[model samples]
Target: MLSVQPVSEAGFAAMAEEWRMCLEASDANPLFMSWPWLYSWWETWSQVLGMELVLLGVFDQRGELVGIGPFCRRVLVTPGGVRVARLYMIGNAWRLAPTVRTEYCAIIARRGSEQAVTAALVPALEQLKWDEMISTDVPVDQLESLKVGRFYDQRGYRMIHRTEDVGIRINTTGRFDDWLAGLGKNTRLKAYNRRSYLKKQGELDFLDHEEGRDGDFFGRLNAFHMNRWGKPAFDREALRFHRLLLQRLHLCEGEPAMSLILYNEHCVSVLYDVVVRGCRYNLQAGYEEDFDPKVSLGYLHLGHAIEAAFSDGATSAYDLLAGNGKNQFYKSHFHGEAVHFSTFQVVRSPLLKALYRIQAASPLFMARGLSRRVGL
Candidate 1:
């Protein structure tokens, strides 16, 4: 039989090696599920929100650590204005700014132990006090693959609260040239011809974190993001968390990467990506605000990044973690597989569950007014 125990911050910290081992042995070894990623969020962003941690450690009969359910408690509002005390996966809280939206969310469990972990979690979770349990940005297949969300439903406790069917998944098989050759004529031009053209515009350079240039890289990335989107991608504390994460990944997962494309003295484009478990996830990016749209400076930079992912023997896929982000309509034109992520919540409170069902049927604005007066 598996046993559940609450872990303190220090206890979780001490489990770093065990966490890494479990992650590597798991079916879904996404960066978001990595210890450094979530722990950094817990140490910085979650702490900033004053959320209370609810880390659960699942142990086998021999007292072997098999899984970790890193959760936190916070009061969150539903689309229908139903305010409930939500027990959210550590990295999958309400998307407050200066925070990241974690995907491939799951209980960090060992490979064959997924079913056991999910089953063990039920009784363990039921013993805790919370109105609902939320695990967001979970890939659809994970229900069967990891025996997660759908497992809860089978146990009589889950709802598909929201679905985000947007992200792009690039199949980076074979060599770079082979992959590039498969692109259509226009895409071929944008990735090659346009990039070559940009290089001729005087002193065009590409710099990355490997050169020990991460200091300036992040600054330029933030500036380009602010100029292009009129807001920053990451604020001070969040940036610190990422910097710590970079260090942690360096020592834990495979080499993480960051890229900055410079045109003369101006930084035209930048991207921050985490490479782990044979996949490169483009977490954030930015580009020149006034650069010629025809040149597609961001696209060119992304081409370079994609090429890097292909070049690396350790990485197999370059996932554009959704959104048409590279300056308005960039992601739409990419040739890659589409991966969908959905947020699943288990509402334990009958009152809150009814309100959410009603809100699901109501108009967008009506959600803001529904259950505003409801307590608990």
Candidate 2:
């Protein structure tokens, strides 16, 4: 028999050893599901955002734990003075969805008893009384075979989907030279010539966070990000949260995974990336926009970075997180492959659902559309 239950702090304490062991086994394993930080992030955000948080786990007949899902609850005030509590979380949390990383990532038994674990969870989810659930940025490929429909449908919850290209990567037959040769001759010459031009400006450098020396790294990173975009790309709150995460975090701990920033003597740029399971998760990247675009510092940084990743044994590099038209232009140049991720909107309250529909369709929609003209 399989059973599901909420994970309490005390209960989590008891499971610490097993939890840590399982998490360390995979880079994509959701670290946000664990104690301390998971709870910290949840509690901190829940208080400010007013979301109820639940850490749920699944266990087998032998009672060996197999899955974890972090469900965040939100209460939406309706038109009729009715207030409904909704439970939702970023998909890819709990290390369940085996693709990109996000909060409350779904976890599943990848090997033993995979089918059994999934079967138990599907029915459990359908029976859940939550008002609304928005599982955002989920790996569609992982859920396709698992049949997510067993738990959700358009009748009860509207399923929405979109895609974006994550970033760039070069296949390595050898070192940087071999990889550059793979690109078209003109592209290769352009990249090489740009590097030659940049060298004349000043020395170029890439810095990674070092123990007790991260302050300088983050400073340079911030400068790079600000330089790339005159205004902040991410919200102030999100950036603050990332700073905290970086302070107490390790990206897969022992791997070559580390936050990096590239700079010339005069300016800087930051590369937002994560290495998980021999794959480089190329998140958002920024460079000094004031620098000459013709010199192509961003492209040069990326070329060297890709070579570095391959040298370190990363098999693949994922571009914008998902593929979109705008994101595809640059991604295509580097031979990016498409991976489908999913988004879901489950609004149990008719009024709130209506509001969401409007919100999704309004002119604000076009204005706030994920796609922007520059910077993928």
Candidate 3:
């Protein structure tokens, strides 16, 4: 028989090795699902938000760990302005906020045991008293394997699915020349011209920094990021969360990488990335605002980083992760495939279900206004 147990923060800390092993065995694992990233995120934000850790650990009859669900309990205001308790995958509550985001969330179940694990998890989840459950950025097949739709239908819970933003992934396995050739002629020429212009302006230097070696880089990076957006990108809590993530990566030997573009010894642009299992996830980036606007330092730095990744043979794909639909412009330049993401909501309350239906039927702008008001 399979058994499920809720693991608190302390319990989770003690089961680091077990969790990591389960992650390794799971087919749906991604950097966001890594023990280091989720643990650090829990440490940084859970208490601040007054949320309770509700991580679930599943074990088989032989007492072997089979799956893990990194979940948390929080209060969410529904579209009708009713506040209710809800459960969500860790880091998912920040989905609408302009903060550090995690994508590709799913139950970390051993490759062939996903169905069984989901069957067990569905019952375990039902035992908890929550108004709704929201999970975002889940892969389509993974969710289907979970059979959440069928499970919810049987239990009379309303399951709603919405198409989220698409995730952009750049395949870097091909030869560098071939990769460049794949980009349209206009984009290729623009990249070349940008690099040439930057090179002529000053001595161009590209530097890579590991986790522990990034000294004052985060501060400068955040400043540049805020300046570019004309507003702050990360709050104090988010900064702390990012710092803890760096430390966690270092401890786990995750080999987090930060690429810097320097012009005459002055940092002009930077790209923070995590490379694991030949997949490079672009976490964050920023560039000096005072640089020559015509040179396009940001684009030049990204091109340099992609080239470096190909040269080092350290990456198979560069994932831009989920973001606003506007990123299609720059991401399209890379000629990458767009992986669509969706959010699934399971509602147990009739009132909430009615509210969701009404919101869904409303005009786009009205629904958006209500969403903002509800803090979605």
TM-score of each: 0.88, 0.72, 0.90
**Which predicted model would earn the best lDDT?**
3
lDDT (Cα, tens digit) per residue for candidate 3, span 64-108: 899987789887665657888788888767443444677888888
lDDT digits (tens) for residues 1-376 of candidate 1:
8999999888877777888877788766458888888888888776678688899989999988888887889876755466678788888655433376777877778878888887888677778888877777778767553334455665455464655657888877668888778777777787667866766767777787555544566777788778777777788877888888888885456566787777886667778887887888888877876787677666677788889888888778998886665447466566778888776667767776676678778897776566454432
Please, what is the whole-model Cα lDDT of each candidate in the order they appear?
0.74, 0.52, 0.76
**lDDT score, candidate 2:** 0.52
Superposed by TM-score, candidate 1 places the C-alpha of residue 116 at a distance from the truth, in angstroms, of: 1.5
Best by TM-score: 3
lDDT of model 3 at residue 207?
Answer: 90
The count of residue-pair clashes in candidate 3 stands at 0
